[model samples]
Target: MKEPAHHIILDAISQSASDIHFHPTPNEVEIHFRINGQRHLYKKIALTKYKVILAYFKYTGKLDIGESRLPQQGSLSFEENKLSYSLRISTLPANSLESLAIRILPQKDIQSLHELFLFPNQFKQVRKCLKNKSGIILLTGPTGSGKTTTLYAILKSFMEDNNYQTITLEDPVEKSFAQAVQVQINPESGLTYDEGLKAALRHDPDIIMVGEIRDQSTAEFVFRAAYTGHLVLSTLHAKDTFGTILRLLDMGIKKLELEQSLLAVASLELLPLQLRKFKNQRAAIIELLEGEILSEAINKQLSPLTAIDFQKLRRKAFAYGYISEENCF
Candidate 1:
């Protein structure tokens, strides 16, 4: 409803900001844009103007405008320059004032698998991981990492080339896919990641992509689904590749189940490239685990896997001139 909201959206798209943050205080609201894995303050909007924009976003996103003491999350679509973007809006209660966050996601695929992975063979490995028709492949990363983008690209490629039944259980249904059945997680509707997985099994899907493994229930469901002979793809948050194992173990996944149902793990890291064609952009390098190396980790025999981690990834990227020395360790 406000012109400032439209202007902010336009400017954020122009700058390719991944997210927009609004910090409201008693005086003014500080606006920040997250670009290339970092946040920079854009400007400060008056408390009056900020409230109007916040209300506009919440109303458009279909969140409860009357409820602010609790938290809320919803999605809204924005169309500009012949392209559509999905804005995931979230509100949090604060001591001073309610805070707002918006994550901007393009409705369509933007980068290919090649562009996503810095090294060419690593791209090949990701494809190899997907070749198996059973077990789960987990993509681990921190916030602002390329886990979602990488997973979407691979899923699209498979949907285009093969005649496979793919089903995704995302919290908000991030992107639209023509052939695959995408389910959104809504606890209010008696549909959650755990419930969705049970329903997905009845569909005889060739591939299942769980949006994320957030808790023990979801993680157990995912592992059980994979154990039943369907390929499962999901994302997890961890510090690194080995950290993925510890996280899963902490979630109560047994070693034997991992050996049987876990296919591969790829932890993604976004690096600022030093190339001409990638100006002002960053690419992902993965700490890939597969086959024997994966088996070793599953068995708690990580002694031989010392050379594989984020340090190795950064070293390889720096050695290959994909990133500058200053950007590497």
Candidate 2:
């Protein structure tokens, strides 16, 4: 049973698949793999064999094998060909069977800031934000838009230059870094975002990374950290750059507090690039709002400076022949 499961994972890795999905039907199990933001059917197995495969994954992932009524999440790491990969498992109960989804995080695929952004000017603007000594720099995007990867690249760049005491509070510490302190939040163990922030403060960190700003309490704590002379980096879910300010305001953060603590807000969207040398690659297009532009947006004042947005970036990409006209929309 385990042999077949391992073979599936190895095949997915070889094919550059980012995720694997298992859907159990009445008669058989459907398997799919996601590669380059597209899903494709990989294989199928009999319903009887799926039970053994599902049990093998649950046991190896350290999930509760007996619990089928509620959702469960677990993660495990594997090494092959001297490269590390992290598998995050999630299971949800359906009508009569459980559906499983696995997200594959490969350390080798992580790219630098220069390689991630489509425009050099955008990279320069982000670098300028990192030079700030204290303030909150928020990265806004939907899931799988490469926010975490950008944050990691920024931290890596800073660590190579200066010995800054950096700390990160993530739900499940994504990637391990030897130069910085990483904390995983386990609410079951009485360690949450708020609690983790309190504990991270005690370590006297010059820079702090909150994995996300999910609620009012976490947002307030992140603001407090920025106000107290610590450079803070975090992510939020929003549609665009302007939407990020509205989101923070909706989360009960005061306008004055945002005015004082916000250094920049970068909203990202990944677009498939049509490079002649490297086909089928993706790059990020960022709508960056910073400095006076950030202040104006937070205050509900509109100006021409706000025109530097995703629409403009998309036009630029199309003009450069990096993307097609249909992709501009």
Candidate 3:
């Protein structure tokens, strides 16, 4: 079918496509879309048509169309279906031509915590941390493990109950919420993560969400925001909950400050390819930290105990994903 690059993108959003891919093949060019976290073949199009789509994105989004040596980034919005997306574009070295990939961002919709199928124990801790008026809650997990969705769910809960100024500083501003203000970090305008976070604080927000805490400035600022009485919810790139402590310490946050300001850290993992069930569904197994044990561990600057040993402790609670009665004493 004949379609402009912008219109093709809008059609993908209408189909609820999560990811789009562009690649060249021996006979023809190939396009793929990841739907519901699984990759599916979309269609094969002619080489010239693919080039037009890439040029369209490069030109309209003000990307570096002339530069074949460096990567480019851009975004497109579709108002008719209330959908938006950000694209990352780059040229392949061998072909000396541009290619593209797009990540979808759906506008926010109301979804309850229970709909995610949380274990009772995990849900209780998550609910407690989110319900608190002021504190820093860290959700750590590998990429594509639903960490962002959990954060969105928490924000949705707050939006349903009362009116408060909630702001999120994300690299691409993935999802939009009705009652919250969202800002995109623009490197071209000197709006790095640190800059965006500083701007967020000046707004006197009731809640602040930092997309990812990579360094000392953001880690320290988020902690300070929590200590100063703003509810902070954000994610970290680490193996599990315990590793989150080590990561902050590595970034220059003191142990005492972390213990004082940080409310909880949750680690999650999406089961490997070997564990996926019969249906298209995938499950996230989560580990949560809280209470006195968590406090002492952070205060002491303890390295996370081994996962093998920690899983043994998890055997004690043995219900939900955390602990179960049959496996416990």
Candidate 4:
């Protein structure tokens, strides 16, 4: 890669970009950085360097240089000092050649739940769920909402205890944990979510992590795993913790099946830290639905938290740390 393109990648990572986009124009190169959920321009580059950057991604990800007309997906792992990153690369055609978007994955040493700036009791709540012998704990959030980070933290907590065998089946296998057996799913190979779960069962895993419950079969696989005495952790794209149950229902998972196996649903939202005095760190607002309240609510199909209750929940959540008053109600 050219010096300019290489610098761009480093700069984007420094800015905490989730993804980078390169677009070629007549004389200018449009560069976009996805920070948080919004996209902002990093800077315009010369068209020549755009080609170099695109080629760099193609080579690094081992993509067919000629196959840019169709959508191509690949990944690259970069290591600098002790910091490592896995870049997810996707290339598609613009008007002529390929336009590339690269996802920036940051590797940070697993932080203790207490060090996460969570309240001591909040840490207790999280750890309590993890200590359960057999059940499903669902983490719900939109894309780029730090669900993976939270899951990883829980895995780290379990790893330190060395109490159980953990296995994870992630679509792209985002990051690695030293103690867990991680598997990557390949659609082309016909090794799907359900197939992977079936294989995991045979391995006698105490904890199983499925990246996401995308469909009915996958949802059933996860529920079955939990029923069979495995502690399951997974993420889902839902509006709130309550919505996770409805999503499973839509996935053709029966209500009774859900009532028996579901242990907890913790939903998190990422909010900008710039809105408050602290600008260096972001806050996660979590809502956990469980026990009799969650069971009754799900069985009745009743949404428990009203707008007022959300305000109260947020107030209580802030007792944890880093969460600002403005972020809640």
Q: So what's the TM-score on candidate 3?
A: 0.74
Candidate 3 lDDT over residue span 1-329, tens digit each: 22666666766776667678787765567888876566778888888888778777667667777776776676755455453444544345336455577766655474666555334655666777777788888888876677887788878878777687999988767676677888988878998766876788798898988877767777886786677688889888888777788888889998778877888887765432222232334345577777765776687756445332335444533433433353334
Instruction: Compose the digit string of candidate 4's lDDT tens values, residues 216-284.
Output: 777887887787788899988988777777888888989898888888888877655553555656656
lDDT of 2 at 26: 84
The candidate, 1 or 2, that scores higher on TM-score is 1
- For model 4, what is the error of residue 307's alpha carbon versus the real structure, in angstroms, after optimal superposition? 9.8
Task: Report lDDT (CA) for all predictions.
Answer: 0.87, 0.87, 0.69, 0.79
Candidate 1, residues 1-329, lDDT tens digits: the string is: 56899999999989999999999878899999999998999999899888899899999999999998999999999999889999999999987578999999988754567768777888998888878989999999998898888888888778767999999999878888777899988989899777888898899899999888889988998898887799999999987788899889889999999998888899999998888888888988888887888888878646344437777778888998889998788
Which candidate, 3 or 4, would have the higher TM-score against the true structure?
Answer: 4
The local lDDT score (0 to 100) that residue 123 gets in candidate 2 is 90
Q: Cα deviation in Å at residue 124, candidate 3? A: 2.5
TM-score of 2: 0.93
All candidates' TM-scores?
0.95, 0.93, 0.74, 0.86
lDDT of 2: 0.87
lDDT for position 166 in model 3 = 93
lDDT of 2 by residue, 183-217 (tens): 99898999987788788889999899988888888
Q: What count of clashes does model 1 give?
A: 0
Q: Give, for candidate 1, the lowest lDDT window spanning 10 residues.
A: 300-309
Clashes of 3: 5
Who is ahead in lDDT, 1 or 3?
1
Cα-based lDDT at residue 197, candidate 2: 78
On a 0 to 100 scale, what is the lDDT of residue 316 in model 3? 33
